[model samples]
Target: MTGHQKTAFVTGASTGFGAAIARRFAADGARVVAAARRIDKLAALAEEFGPTVLPLQLDVRDRAAVAAAVDGLPAEFADVDVLVNNAGLAKGLSPAQQADLDDWDQMVDTNCKGLVYCARALLPGMVARGRGHVINLGSIAANYPYPGGNVYGATKAFVRQFSLNLRADLHGTGVRVTCVEPGLAGGTEFSVVRFQGDQDKADAVYSGVQPLTADDVAESVHWAAAQPAHVNINIIELTPVAQSFAPLRVHRDTD
Candidate 1:
């Protein structure tokens, strides 16, 4: 509003969808506040984008830090026009019965709680300004459950519902909420982190079929944000062409 340049606050911007979204906004002449746990990667973004990108080292899991960061934004970057909640992850593929408690906790903290923390901090400003967009990163697992996807899928389900509810709450406020759910994506640290840095296993997950790239996801975000004031894109669900629904499994008695 000050200089007519939109400002976007992006979380988990050190890599993957976050970084790509930051890059897209910066290239489009928007000021971007890129926040993540990895300062080094964020620094690279700032260096590449120059003054258009402000790198902030932040862990969304820390509510205090998230609040402080939003409250302390500099004059030029304070009026955030877009908030991208893309900092989420899958911890492990273990069945619920054998899943690690730590993994479940981490997933819950980062995927669900961390997301809400950022939203709660920023939505007030957006509502007051009467103009803003909140784009959340969700997953297809939320709709289609599979083996070893117990907690991770559940967390994404929360995202789906949360986005819809925000729409209801922010009705007539001139604010927009969108949830982008991606399936079988590649070219990111998502699988690696989920597999606990097992490169071989991560590679295997995407070995055969071509999957969605970070750029693809970024483009979806950009499109949703670029819509006219009266337009609201509620949800965008995308998957590789090679992927589709499968038949339900049935177990026959062998005795």
Candidate 2:
């Protein structure tokens, strides 16, 4: 493993944090495999990064597709030294009593089961090689649950626990696991996707404040990946200065 150029596999790399992470790793001289469900978007990323980036159309929710993609990777990028589990989303904003069960299922399937599938598919090779790193994208909701966060928050909590448990299980195996949690990230598909493409509503989410950008989270991911093999950064929680914690910001009809 020493002196060999490393390869990184990042899920959800069509845009947002995943795209930034893929670019950063490519710039750092690591061969990057960027996978997402959007083939055209992934093609654009590959075009932008050239041969160093391999863009594959992959849906994390499909276990068979995930395995096929991983197994079909070229030999040069087959032995992934880093795996970033970043394919997830928040579907509906509703309280537990009113929440859409379908949305809840999607969140759980992607955030938890999808992450598990990726890890399970990749970890054995990492362990066999005796060197690798795993970075799972968590959120502030994991610790500070809000009324509408319901299942989304719960899934992140699972991510937090899963990362720690993976670290424990992989102890002494030269494999490291980390969870990167961000508070209020903007300039990504987060709010847009959450609001289901309601531009006005999405814009309102970051209207008056400067939220953390995809680059910020990407930088953190790079920092974790760049650490020495022996050094395992457990969890990193990053938030913009303007945001502290989740709260109901009610604006009365002053006018």
Candidate 3:
């Protein structure tokens, strides 16, 4: 295959935004390497996208596993032109003083360190090729801190800044870095994971609100990826019309 048919590596592709992004890339005619911790779910995606979708078991928090998985990519998909770091979540809703240290550790490990691991493992090749794109999934919480988003928000802030810094570091090279921040995304595992599988709590997050869906965010990523090589979109924050910043919410009690 020609260099134009280069592959894309997407992390956290089991479901939600990650899965949607992977499928979108496949539909756009790029070979996609979809990685996630859930092998069964990845397998399902591979079945749907056919041979163009290569599903691999990966846990971003595991540094060695991340390196091994990227190193193990097939020759056809080894020369990646795009890398999407979308494997992250918020664990608990607690004040910084009352939050569990374990939850904070998990967030930092997966969101911050995991991104570094993937970038370190794959970026050298992109730098050498002098052409590539890196899209890091960020959150509105990165800018507007909420009562319960103490550490999760901080991690995303790191992602936002890191993308800019990465872009600076890659100056003169053809590689581009971008941060995609989404606010109030529904129909995904985000709130569900934040609520620790509490279906009622997860459902309440989008109650009576038209929140952004996984496809909305996926479409934004696709737009960024398809931009001309000379055009580099820095940061894009997408939110649902029904939702605003945390302090802007109006609550009503119906009797």
The number of the candidate with the highest TM-score is 1
Query: For model 1, what is the error of residue 141's alpha carbon versus the real structure, in angstroms, after optimal superposition?
Result: 0.7
Q: Higher TM-score: candidate 1 or 2?
A: 1
Model 2 residue 22 CA deviation in Å: 0.6
Q: What are the TM-scores, per candidate, against the unseen true structure?
A: 0.98, 0.94, 0.94
lDDT of 2 by residue, 59-102 (tens): 89999998988899999889999999999999878788998888
Q: What local lDDT score does residue 140 receive in model 3, on the 0 to 100 scale?
A: 91
Residue pairs clashing, model 2 = none
Say which candidate scores most in lDDT.
1
TM-score of 3: 0.94
Write candidate 1's Cα lDDT for 4-30 as tens digits.
689999999999999999999888889
Error of 2 at 241 (Å): 0.2
> How many residue pairs clash in all the candidates, one count each?
0, 0, 0
Model 2 TM-score (2 dp): 0.94
